[model samples]
Target: MLYWLIKHVLLGPVLRIFFRPEIEGKENIPAEGGVLLASNHLAVSDSFFLPLMVPRRVTFPAKIEYFTEPGIKGRLKKAFFTGVGQIPIDRSGASAAQAALDTGVRLLREGNLMGIYPEGTRSPDGRLYRGKTGIARIALQAGVPVVPIAMFGTDKANPIGSKMWRPTKIRIKVGEPLDFSRYSGLDGDRFIERSITDEIMYALMELSGQEYVDMYAAKAKEQAQPLPDRLPESRAS
Candidate 1:
């Protein structure tokens, strides 16, 4: 109810006017079934824009903190994310990541599209990064096609911590649905996951026209920061 209300009544109509997203190959998305939307995380708006353009409702697992924080800000945060149909997942560590994938798989099993950032977190830099294999695991577990979606230019609209929205032409390109059934059944080989990750990235590379980095997106993002500890999940050592 809340999701539809926002999608139709409130926010949707407004966003449709200003942040006009030029979507390409939208037909690549399955008509009515579960699918894994593996997309590059460029900006916060990336989440809403793609889902808004799609006919089917896509669900992404947001960080749990978005819902559990206390106070007025927390309440607003919860309302905003829930209205967009984001499920909360804990990103504490590996176990939590598995749990997140588990939740995503559950959604897919129910014939719902599950959107994920294989890079695990937002890429501070615009460069493409390596994706974790959790997406592959879900693809195997749920028997759903993985659709690689790439987004560009939204980063300029909302860069890092700008309060107001900027006018930037957003481009979203969808790739053909990729089937991994043959490799999905492989016995716990790391190569299988790596291959799946490469397939998705290759599609994104073609769509976004960005140089592909064999490293993790989160790591590329971390390197841009001056923090004492800048390691990211699934970093290529």
Candidate 2:
């Protein structure tokens, strides 16, 4: 099968030999049923590397732009992402966020393992930012447990906005699954959402050893936006 070939034959050996990622607490992942692996996003590689180490097929909802384009280039890109098992969701507006969570809920309801970046965006300074309530909403509504995952040193392994990368030690720490069963009676209420997000962030803090900020990841990203982050200045600047 292509899955095994990619995991065990190709990417598996190459990643183990080159990056030398140190994965701890993998046992925290549930062996069966629907589970969420909520983590911090530090680099683009976070998406690929995290899933590679996991034994189960961990799926994430990638932006629809990954599949949308005109021509052969677009088709090839779409096929590649599809082959890797990433679900495409239109992330355009308020509805975009909702659609991702909606899709994730459906996957959970089907007893699948879903991976999400609670911080939402890569932390600009590597410090853990506040997680969005969306993660909590997904867990509570879907009635599944969330496992806190902390990925460290990935940005250094493949720093953002760089065309070249260096081999560096990467660490992935999977904390214990968080039980939101107490909110089983609350359903989709705001109170339960906040509680779930807080618990997830706390676990990430312990694992990643980063200072925690109380603001949402998006807001933190806005504050840390680079000069090129403007219409004029950019990473190339």
Candidate 3:
């Protein structure tokens, strides 16, 4: 009820008016059944826009911090996220990856559309990064097809450090679902998981037309920061 209200009555109408988001190949999404939406992470708005455009309720795993903070502000934040249908998963500890995978598989098995970012984190430089294998693992375990979704212009609208969204044209391209039924029993195989993840990334690269970086986005972000002591290059010849 809250989800529908927010998507339709409250936030959705406002976003649609300003951004005027567009979508292509939306028919590729399955009409029914459990499926995984494997999307490239760009801006934070990727979560908001994708769900707004899709017909069904999309559930994404949010970091546990969003729900576990202290005070009244934290309580409100937790309530809002929970009301909007996000699952909280601890992104710390050794079991984090496995816990997330389990959450996705369970959602898929329950006939829900589970949205996942295979790249694990937002791209620091707007290029498609190598995908983590957890998405592939979930797909194989859930025995569902993976639909590749590419988001464009979201970074411009809601940039990495920006607090407010600007009115930028947003576009979404949905690629045909990739079926890995051939590898039905190969979920636990690391080699197969990597292969599947690579294939999904390839599809996203083609759809988004972004340069494919063979590194994880989180690592790229870490390497992109300049040292505090580094001096600016001299302009003097």
The clash tally of candidate 3 reads: 0
The regions of model 2 sitting more than 4 angstroms off are: 226-237
User: How high is the lDDT of residue 113 in model 2?
Assistant: 92
- List where candidate 3 sits over 4 angstroms from the true fold: 228-237
Score every model by TM-score.
0.91, 0.90, 0.94
Q: How would you encode candidate 3's per-residue C-alpha lDDT over 80-187 as one tens digit per residue?
A: 887667889998876897888888999999999989999999999899999999888999999999999999999999999999999999999999999999999999
For lDDT, the strongest prediction is 3
**Model 1 TM-score on a 0 to 1 scale:** 0.91
lDDT of each residue in 61-159, candidate 2, tens digit only: 888889997799999888767766688988789988888889999999999999998888888778898888888888888989999898987899888
lDDT of each candidate versus the true structure: 0.85, 0.84, 0.92
Q: For candidate 2, give the lDDT.
A: 0.84
Candidate 1, residues 1-237: lDDT per residue as tens digits?
Answer: 999998888988888788787888899999888899999888888888988888889898998998998999999989989999898999898899789878988899999988988877777678788888888888888889999899888899888788887988888889899998887567257788888878888888887788778888766766777768856679587
lDDT of 2 at 50: 85
